[model samples]
Target: MDFTNLLATEVQTFINQNIDSDINRLLLKRSSFPNVTIQEIVQQIKGRKVAQRKFPFLLNENIIFPPNLNLEQASSQSTAEYKAKDIKGKSFLDLTSGFGIDAFFLSQNFEEVTLVEQNPELIKIVEHNWKTLNRKADFINQNLEEFLESLGQAANDDFRKFDVVYLDPARRDQNNKKKFLLEDLSPNLLEIEEQLHSISDKIIVKLSPLIDISYLVSELQNINEIKIIAVRNEVKELVLIIENKPSTVNQQPTTISCINLESDEPEFSFYINEEKTATSEFSESLDFLYIPNNSMLKAGAFNIISKKFGLKKLHPNTHFYTSEHKLDNFPGRILQVEKIDGKDLKKNDQFNIISKNYPLKPDEIKKKYKLKDGGKRYLIFTQSINGKEILRSV
Candidate 1:
C-alpha cells in the first residue's frame, strides 16, 4: 500500500510504537515499504494534528515544536519565559524569522507582528505552526533585500512602524562553518543599515555565543546593552540591543554584567572602568591573583578588569594577572598560591591541571609532570608577568 493511504491514525500509532526506535534505520531495513519516506513519516505522524505522536516525548506542552522542526533536542526552553517578561501589546517585527521561535515569543508581546522569512519551506512551516496556535501575524515570504525595498517605497503613513525589530541572521556559511561576526554573513550588512535605522526604534540581534563580545561592541554602533545569556549554567546566546537614537549626553563608564541564571543569588555586576582603575605594578610577592571569567576574557577588557580589582596584568594579552589582596566577589576563579615552584611540580604527586589562554594543553603538561587527573586541589597552569610558565592554586 502507498504511504499516503496509511491513515493519520495508523501513522501516529507507528510513530508511538517505534518512538524510541530509529525510524530511519527501520525504514532502511524494511525495503518493502518503498514509498514511505522519512519526510513523509515526519509530516504524517508528528505535530498536533496527530494525537498519538504529537508530544514527541522530548518536548513539554509549552514547547509547541522542536527547534528547526528537527526531532533532535531543542536549543532552549519555550519562548514562554521571554514572552512573559518582555513581549506584550507592542508592534514587533522579526526581520529574520528562522523557524519562527523569536516571532512566536515576540507575538506574545505585540498585538501585531510581521515575520519576514526568505525560505519558502520555513515560511510555510512557520505559517502552519502560527495557525495551529491561532495567533494573528503577517507572514512575509521574501528575501530581506526585496522586503526592505518594498517597505522603503511605501509612504510613511502606509509603512508598518515597529516598536521593536528582531534579527537573527543565518550565522553559518554554505559549508556549515559558524560565522562569528556580523560582517561575515551574506548580502552585506551595509545595505540594511539605513533601512534598519529607519524602520524601528529598538533593535535586538541574537548572536553566536562563541563570538568575542568586545569585537561586537566595537563594530556595532548605537548599542545600548549586551546581554550574555546562560541557561542552566551553559551559555546559550548573546543579545545585543541597539537604540535608534544615540544619547548625546556622555554616559557613565561601560560595565560588564554577568547574569548567572542557575544561581539563586542576585546577578553579578562588575564595573569595567573601576577594574581598570585597580591596575598596579606586578609584584612577585603578591599573595593572590584574580582571573576574570571566560565571558569577560572574551570581552577583552583586561585593563578594565585589572584596575577594577587592583590587580596587575601579567602581560598585555595573557589575560592572567596577579593582585596583592583577595576579593570576595571576583568574577573568575581566585587562585591563592600555596606553592610556586615549577621544579617542585615535576616532583609532586599528581595535579589536576587546567589551561586557558596558555600555551600548553593539559595532557602535554600532565605527561611531562607525570600527574593524574583526580584531585580536590585545583591547579592553574598559566604564564606569569615575565611570560614564563607558572602554576598557581585557588
Candidate 2:
C-alpha cells in the first residue's frame, strides 16, 4: 500500500495529462515510470477524476487518495467546507480521520488540530499531503478508543482541552453490515460519552441521515442543535452538536436547521415545537402550489412552513400547500397552476410531473401516460380539502 514512490514528478505529470484517458487502455500501454505499476497509475487517475468535481481543490494538488471505498465514504468537499464554518476553536480533534477531508478543512479554522486514524498507511498519506499544502497537523496513528484513553499525551499538552471533538463514527459493523443504531456504531458514541466530555466541552457528530433524530435526542444528553445538511435538495448528513452539560426533554427544544446548499433554494431554520404547536388551515385548490425542498421536508416543519408564508395546507397529511398570493423567499418551488384534464396527461408529454397523496407516482404516471420529464410546464396531482383529487398544470 506504499504509494510515496508513485508520487514522483514524472508519474504525477503523466496522471495529470491522462486524467480523462480510458483506464483499461492506459493500463495496457507501457509504463513510463517503470517503478510505478499501471494499476497504481489508474488509481491516481480514478482518484483525481472523482476529486476534480467532488473535491475540486484537491485535484492535481499532490493529495494521496484512498481506495474506492474510502473515496466513497470521504466527505465531499462541499459538505466538509460547510461543516468547517460551524466549528470554532484554537484546537480540535478528529476522532476517526478516514481520508482527512474534514480534518483538512477544519485545519483552516483551528490553529492546532489532531487527526486520529487507525490505519498507518492513511496516516502517512495525509501527513505527506498536509505538509505539501503548508498545513501542520498532529497525526496520531491510533484507533478512537486508544486515542481517547491517551488524551493526556496529546501532541501539545497545553491544547489538550479541545474546543470541539469531532467524530463521524463508522456506521458499519465488523462484518461490514450497515448499522443504524447508535450503540452499534463504533467507537460507540454513547459508550464514550463521559470520556469525550472530559476531553472537550463541545462535540460535533456526523450521523447517517436514516438515523432517527428523536432517538438521538433521547439517547444523548446535551443536544444543542441538529443540522440537516443537504446539497441540491438531496439530504446528505445529519449533524448533531452536543455540549457537556446535562439536558432534559423539557429543556429548550433542539433547533433544527434545514440547510439547502443549492444557490436557488432558501435555508429554513425552526424549532420542533413550532411545527407541533402550529395548526394549518386547510384549503381546496388555489392559484399556486408550494412544494418544500427535501431538507425542509426532512426537518418535518410542514405546519410551520405554511404558517410562516401565509399559505394553507391542501390536506392534513398531504403535506401540500397552496396560496392565492405568491410568497417571496419561499423555501421550495412555487408553481402557478391551471387545472388540467387528467385524461389528457398523455397529450402534455414533455412536462415536469409531480404527485403527492395521489394514486399513481410520478414515474407510474409518466409511464402510463407516455410522458417525458422536464420543461417550463408543471403538472401536479394532489388531493384537495373537499376530498377532490386535483391534477393541475402550468
Candidate 3:
C-alpha cells in the first residue's frame, strides 16, 4: 500500500506503530519534505488520532485539535491548571494568544474573553479546539499592534475596557534563542507601554522562569505582585501583576506569593511584609536552620527575611542567610546542623550532600563528599556561610 494513499486512521496507526523509529527526526532530515507543510502532519497526529487513541491520557480531555498544530508550542497541563486559577472570573484580553491554551482556560472564569493571534494557522487550530471543547470565545486574527490600536480607539469612546490584559509574549526567535529578560522581548513592551496601559486597568504578564525577577520588577514600575508558581514542587512560570495606578493605601505592603499547585494542603501561604513580620529578627544561633520561601528569595526581601526569621545574611549577593534556630511555621527546608566542615568534605565518607545558592551543584557536591544520592540525609553545602561550609545533622 502506498503511504500517501493511506486513510487518516491508517496513517495515524502507522505513525504510532513506528514512533520508536524516530519519524519526527526522519521527517526533519529529508530535504524533499516541505518544512512549512509539516504542520498538517502534526495537527492530524494531535487533533484526531491522538484524541481518539489517547483520550484517557490527557488532562484536558474536552479540548481537541487537528494534526496541524506544532505540539512543541502546546502549553503543559500544569501551566493550563495555573492559568485556569489566575484568569478565572476576570474580563481578560490575551494580547498574544499562541495556541489559545491560556485564553481557553481563562475563558472558563470570565464572562467574556478576546484572544488575539497573529498567526493564521494557529488561530484556526485554536478555533477548532475551542469548538471541540464546546467553549465560546472571541478569536481575533490580527497582530497585537493592530488589536491594541483598535482597543485604544474603543477605550477613548468608552467602549473597550478589560479588568485584566494578559501577555505571554513569544520568548524565542526564529532560531529559538531563550529570551527571558524584559529587554530581549519582541515588539518589545518597553516600546509599547503607552498603548498597552491605555487599554487595560490591570495586566498579568507570564514570563519564563529563567528570568531574573529583580530585573523584571525594576523594568515594569507598575508591578504590584510577583508570583513564583511551582507545580509538583518544580518551578514553572513567574507571573507579574501590574496595575493601572497605585492603590489608595500608599503604605500597603507588596506581597510575594509562592504557590505549590500539587500540594494537598493550602499550598504553604505567607505574607512577606506583614506588620508583625516586618519588625521581627532572627536569633543568633539555635538547634535548626530555616530557609525562607522561594518567593521571598525571588523578591530579594533580604531585610524583611532577616528580621522575620531572625537570620543573618551570610553575604551581600548570596541569597542564603543563616539562622541558628528554626521556626515551626517556616515554609522552606529545615536542616539540623550535624557538623561544620570547611574545605574538608573530601576527607569525609558516608555523608549525604546537598547544595543550594552555592557555587557547586548537587551532583558535584556529592562527588566531592564521596556520597551517594537519595536519603533523609542532612548534608548541606552553601557558599553564603563564609565560603563553602558543610553542615550535617548530628
Candidate 4:
C-alpha cells in the first residue's frame, strides 16, 4: 500500500481537523482528493486518534498506521518502554513484529537491530515509519519459522547470533478468535524454543495474560523470570524471560515480578515456588481492608501477600486481607471499612460494589439490593472465616 498520497500535507491537515468526527458519517462522505479515498483518509485519522494515547511517537508526519487489528494488537508505549528499560545488548532481533511498536523501543539499546514480519504491507508501513522517525533496522518480510531455519543453516563463519531475541506471537487463529495456550500461538513457542535459544541466549516472549503461569513454567525450559505488567490496576501483559542454562543449574526457581505501572503501588516480586510453602492467617473484619492489585491477584500470591504484608486473610477463598493498623506502601488499595448488616443498605443507594468469593456477582447484588453504582463509598461483599460478610467503606 503506497502511503505517499495519504501523507500529503492537505490530507494530514484534514485528518487533524476532524480528529473527533463520527466515523460512520465520514465513511458516508466521498473523498475530495482524487489520489486518496475516504477509507484511506479515515484510516489515517483513526491511526492519529489511537496514536494520541497508545503510541505518541508515531504522531509524526509520514508515519503510516496499519488496519485496526494490527493497531489493537500493538503494545502500548508504556509497556514497551518498561520492558526495554533494562534490556541492552550488541545485537537484537524481533521475530514477530506486528506493528513494530515493541521492536522500536526494545531495539533502542542494541547496537544492531532486525525485524521480521510475515505481513508484507505491515512490514512496509513499519519500515516507512521507522525511516520517518530516523531509526534504522533491517526489516525482513518473511515467516519467522523460515527465517530461523535460514539462520540455522548459515555457514559456521556466517552464522548470526543476536544478544537478545524477542517475540510477541500472534494469539488469534484463522477465524480471528483469541487463543491462550502455548501450542495455539503462531510460530508455536514449543516448536521454536530450541531454535530461538540457539540464536540468542536471552529469549523474551510476550504472552497473553490469560495464560496460566504454572502451565508456562511446566512447558517452557530455563525460564528465568515471569513478569506480570499492569496499567492502572488492569493486568495487560505477561512476559517470560528464558535463558539458555546448563541442565544441572536449570533447577533454580523462577522469579515472578508483579508490576502495576502508572500507579503508586510498589513492584512485588517472589519466587514461583515460594507461594507453595507460604501460609495465611485468617481473621474476621478489621479496621482496614487491603485489596491486592490485579497483577498480584493474577500472580496468585494470595497467601504470600498476607504473610509479607502482615495482614490476615478473610477466608480460604477470598483474596481480601485485613489489618488492625494501617500498613504503608502496600502494593494495592487500602480502605477503612467496617462490618455492615444487609439492612443498612437502603433502596436506590449508590455505592461502588465489589464482590469477591461471593455467591452473587456485583450486578446481582445491585439488583437484589436496588442499589446504584459509582460513589465515594464502597460495599464489599465477600466471605470471611465466620461466613458471608458485608463491609462498607467508612
* Candidate 4 error regions (>4 Å): 156-159, 248-251
| Candidate maximizing lDDT | 4
**Tens digit of lDDT per residue, candidate 1, span 1-394?**
1223333455446655664565457655542234555555544334433323322222322223332234221224332244235545468888887766566665675777899988776676667667656778899999988887888888874364678888876667889776776778754454576678788867777777787766765776667666666543456666766776756866554455554454332345554445546454554325676666655554555676655566777666567667667766766667776546667765456666877557779888777777777677766666655555565564
Task: Report the lDDT tens digits of candidate 4 across residue range 112-170.
Answer: 99999999999999999999999999999999999998998888732479899999999
lDDT of each: 0.61, 0.82, 0.62, 0.92
TM-score of each: 0.74, 0.93, 0.73, 0.97
Instruction: Using TM-score, give the best candidate's number.
Output: 4
Candidate 2 residues 88-181, lDDT tens each?
7798889898888888886688888899999888888888878878889899999788777777667875656888888999988878899999
Q: What residue pairs are clashing in model 4? A: none
Question: What lDDT score goes with residue 275 in model 1?
Answer: 53
When summed lDDT is taken over every stretch of 10 residues in candidate 2, the lowest stretch is: 244-253
The TM-score measured for candidate 3 stands at 0.73
Model 1, global lDDT = 0.61
